[model samples]
Target: MSLTSNKSSSVLSYLESVSTSDLISDPASIGLTIRELLRRFGGASETTSLTLQDLELAFGKSIALGFSLWQHMAALDRLSAIPDWLANNAPRVANLRNGSAICGLATTHLSSPVTIHGSPSPNGYVVSGTARWVSGFNFFDNLILGFETSDAYCFALIPFPQPIIPIGSSPDSIRCDFRLLDLTALQSTSTGELTLENFPVLNTQLLSRREKNARPAPRKSSLKIPELGVAKSVSKKINSALAAKQTHPLSTDFASALAQINSRITQLEAERCDDSLDLAGPCHLLIQDTLRLFALLSGSRSLAAGSEASRLTLEAMLFDVFLQSENSMRLKIEAAAR
Candidate 1:
């Protein structure tokens, strides 16, 4: 179902009921909020542009929660590509839908030099290497990991907490360790470094396997939704501040910039184009500009820890690194240099 105006307002109201500080201090609270949302709004399959627009609305309320929800929904989207797996895992899918189980994506290795190699085994494959960044550590019950083998790139769903090995399996069959990273922002996400040594992935858990050099699937514009949400949130705050002090020297300039950025975001959303490369740099640049404007408007108050301005500034910095691709990185550099 589409996330109608009433549903978006409902989500915002529910988020408003909890203080941001309290939500950040307790990651489980974010999980509960997601569960409540799933129970009310339905599952990832139901996530449309309106659903994402609701998340964009969420960014103004809580960045951490918005980011976490995006991660969950993205994971669901990836899983949907593997129809055979979904057909066989009905109960697991139900748990995911109902929020009885939470899943995180660990596919940054696909773009990074860090390699999680999978060696073929009788059961499936043994994966060993470090997955550089995995959010939702303590809160996730499963992880969808991407790894490289000799001939292909593979995706697999592995149980978190390291499931027990089957009888007759070697003692070192499955070993996984999680090290929580101390992040400057989004600490509530519990992002961490995941180390896997001789971790076995059963055949049933295997999702998609593609040739290492195979052409990637068409890009989706939905990927930009979260970033747009963040940009919109920053713009709204700046506009609110400008409204309060209409005579401020930079008010008109900032207003114009916000209008242009909002117009661009709306245009992109309406097009729903499959060209992320063309969108990434402009989106990042707009967000960066709005963040700086907000900081300027807040003055010294934005520098203070736990301040909303400070929180958003740091969160925007974190997004700069989130799912960075070589092309996106180059585009951002080009945009910044302009």
Candidate 2:
């Protein structure tokens, strides 16, 4: 059966009850949340006898993470892959299934794309690359990194503090430590820089690689739940502030816009479950509008430090550069020019 509004609301309500302190830590609360969430929907794996409907509900549960950005982003690394990634890689699934986080380090800034390379070796391959701004992933012991081989790009599942075996003096390889960066936003996420130098990814560890001369999948950074959360929470705050002035045209207009955005989200989600439709593109615009509305209507409260409005203001800017698409960035640049 499809998840109803009541069931979805129940899951969101559970997220609201979970405190920030409970969600971000070693053995992250997000994992616990996912584990608990799985109970209601069979589980998040294909091996577990989960029906197609059950699997859909399990994926839907992640939308609740939007309520807590800390949990949402931290959990995104592992949750986004779910049963498919997990079921395919059974060898590592034992550790991963036990609340472990598997971070994907594919996001790259226009100026600094993934510079890592993997070359063929007698045994498997030798990987050396630099993946930047890898947040939330550091908390876990496992990481799924992408590197460009001589012919194509490939993904490898590597354990943290990876070891290098001596092979007739291949030069003693040194694995580096993760350094948490103090970003303007998502500072709470423990965002860090990952520098991998001559790291070894055994053939057993290599997950999937892009085929030589094959077309790459379209890149669409879909982050609907968090955007929806921002809209829902910020709008509620605005609604409350204007409770006495409900009939005011501005308040009415804000309410109308929020409804329209919500309706759009539902329609789009019903269309597909994946990030293929440039979901972030539309959601980003709606979120930007909500942020502007909050700033304009919330008045002095928006300026206060540590306030939701202030935090969201930074977050609004975060989505653009945070795993944003080239097309979206180009559109933003064009809009600025106009």
lDDT of 1 by residue, 81-196 (tens): 67788888878887787677878888734764646889899999988888777888767788889998998888888776442334565756566777888886778888887888
Per-candidate RMSD, Å:
3.5, 5.8
Which digits, one per residue and each the tens of the lDDT, describe model 2 over residues 1-338?
Answer: 44554555555566566664334332255445654544543233434322223222322222223322333333344334545666575654533333333333333221335577777877678876566666554344555566787677777666654333445544546455566766555554455677666667788776566776887654443333344555555556666766766776688777776677667756655654675555556666666776777787777878998665666676566667664567767767776698
Off by over 4 Å in 1: 1-3, 43-50, 112-114, 162-173, 213-221
Error of 2 at 168 (Å): 17
- Best-performing candidate as measured by TM-score: 1
Residue 23's lDDT within candidate 1 is 59
Per-model TM against the reference: 0.87, 0.72
User: Which residue pairs in candidate 2 collide?
Assistant: 116-129
- The alpha-carbon deviation from the true structure for residue 327 of candidate 2, after best TM-score superposition, in angstroms, is 0.6
